[model samples]
Target chain A: MYFGGSFSRGDFLFLLSGAVTTLSITLVAVVIGTVLGVLFGLIRAGAPWWIGNTLGAVLDVFRSVPLLIQLVLFNSFNSMLKLNWPTFTVGCICLGIYASAFCTEIVRSGVGAVPQTTRRAARSLGLTWRQELTSITLPIATRIVFPSWIGLTLGVMKDTALVLWIGIVELLRSSQIVTSRVQEPLLILGITGLIYFVMSFPIARLGNQLEKKWGTQ
Target chain B: MDYEFQWRPVLRSLPEMLWGALQTIEIAGLAMMLGTVLAIFLALAKRSGKKYLSLPADMWIETARNTPALFQIYMLYFGLGSLGLQVGSYTALLLGITFNNAGYLAETFRGGFAAVPETQTRAARSLGLGAVQTQWHIVIPQMLRAVFHAMTNQMVWSVLMSSLGVIVGLTTDLTGVTQKLNVVTYRTFEYFFVAACLYYLISKAFTLSARVVAWRLFRY
Candidate 1:
């Protein structure tokens, strides 16, 4: 009896479109998050003490605050500042910013996990700081932190659902709209959950595979 | 740009904000207590050798971990209502938060179980203790230590996530009141700043309490 009165093919399509939007947002956010995370990690790991401390404080504040609050704050701020950025853009920025905090710590830990000997060897080869980081440090660190990084990436994808609360029309929001019409909450939720699982399952499996392959090395 | 900072609106809303903070703590405490009990069962079930016992537990953990807590709350609150269950928003919110908390807490306890040395468990068994007795007396104490920090981390997360219950129309929680104030006063910074401070204080208090408990429990 689920989806009984008001179900239609269009509702399924809307849900599918919502999944697409979620995926797109996650993809963009993850890309931005990883790049910024690496930059912040490098700064924290190798920069001057003042620079490192500033980035460290930023990470702490960002990580401590809830993502929901950050999203809402950013959305309101965007309007207040007259930035005229789309809600989706604000959603992506907030997500990327939030994810980057965790990612920075992950990347910093990876960088720290690299041995002092390696750094010394790179310096002995007359490589500059940037050169040594690119050639020696990051490669090893990436391998070392692949598991946790992948875990954080999956976390980002899941956290994107929060954007729906701000009216982003992501999967859950789409499902809510459909459920309101169809009056079959369980079935709608089950379907929406299945959609999320389908999206998340492959990433998680890939993460596991990466962890198994690189974690031991 | 001419911007005036308004303190009066925020001041007027302070009492409601305080009430919201109380509600936030109430939801968090209830959810954490329920979650801890559920987590113990989940940890045990996952560690159980039988597939029948372990598979469902594993599925629950994976699903909860992979999806957003927001979606889970929506599914419970709005999705359930659309199914004709007719539960109140607060009941739905609590159920959703407890379910998600149990999922994460299960992982924490599982980590603790993994950290418990097998030799200790074996020593207890050789002393003629049954599985339950060995678990209760020998394994659990050690496991609790390993899990303590992780549980504290989960508590902080649960407090933050409880904010999402506002979307489901639970008007008593901190996030709920913030949303209401934001709509009415259009004072984003003032309202969110207050809410943020409240959350920060609560999380700090939780962290300090956990530290005290860990010191007393571990004694080293």
Candidate 2:
């Protein structure tokens, strides 16, 4: 009967909802991460001497450890500190923090790639440091970093699966539930893999196109 | 409320954790070696210009890249088991990682291959070197050197990814052993912290050695 029975309509809907949850979590984390990443990027690249160096060193710890460990540690931190937030909030926080570290590096390098002559030109034209960064450095840097940003987006989407470790029941967890109930692990997992492929392929191909286009300029 | 930090349990379990770290390295090293070999064939298949070879290679790379490594491992371990094909946890983890690594590395190698200009291939042919001989003697070496740093990054990835083995009831690796220890003693912070440190140390060691190796091999 395990092999004989096919998935019901409800099963398909449950899996689709899981996909929605996965996308939602990824979307929120990307927004939070991008904002925090830009702030940290500016701090590392533009702030005063000790501040920048210290922030860089601190973020390196996040970069070095695995995200799974980061999730567990964050859970412990939440419990120990008695914050008692929901698991989804904790998942979003951990992923946001994780993405911030990498994005900080991405942003810093993107900004760094801007030529010094361009910055000086802005300065000579009476632009303040803030104006220079916003009008001149950031626009050029953003184009340079767009391709890497696409790669990062794809990465964070896939990594949302790890949140299932803390029992958030996203796409992968949904499939696991179905497989356990149906005794059809291969079919469930195959469908899950296909879903992820559908989601990520276009982004990756777009990144390639962007790289070629931006690379020429 | 003050949450007092304790260190003794973590200290006492240091040896077990160290052994776990060794197993982590063992799995990652083996996967990298296996994956790199498979990746060369994959890269060649993509470059072969035949529809069958290139299409399959592209599919594998896209599937491996697009999906989470966890999905790949689950399909191999649980999915296969349900389909009546049982593999041990270690083999499943290794194969999953190798599949992922080979896919990513195949792309990295393709970039490296492209970096070697077409004129070089033409020159090799003009010099009467056979195709295999040309690739073996010239293209592969340059490709290795060009992509050496990317390979090092992938090696670090494999090590970190080995931590996912804990999900599949793998008990021998660092994260698995840490989880088991966490169960016995609820010193979650201390044990996980130590495991993180071990991972960081392993990655640092690999990265440092990679630089030295790069300097030596690529000096020409």
Native contacts recovered by model 1 = 0.56
lDDT by residue for model 2 (A124-189), tens: 999999899899999999999989888988999999999999889999999988876777788888
Error of 2 at A114 (Å): 0.9
TM-score, cand. 1: 0.94
lDDT per residue for candidate 1 within B47-117, as digits (tens), equals: 99889989999898877877788878877776667667787878877888898999888988998999998
lDDT of each: 0.86, 0.91
Off by over 4 Å in 2: A1-5, A48-50
Give the interface RMSD values of the models in order.
Answer: 1.7, 1.0
Off by over 4 Å in 1: A1-6, B82-84
Interface quality of candidate 1 as DockQ: 0.60
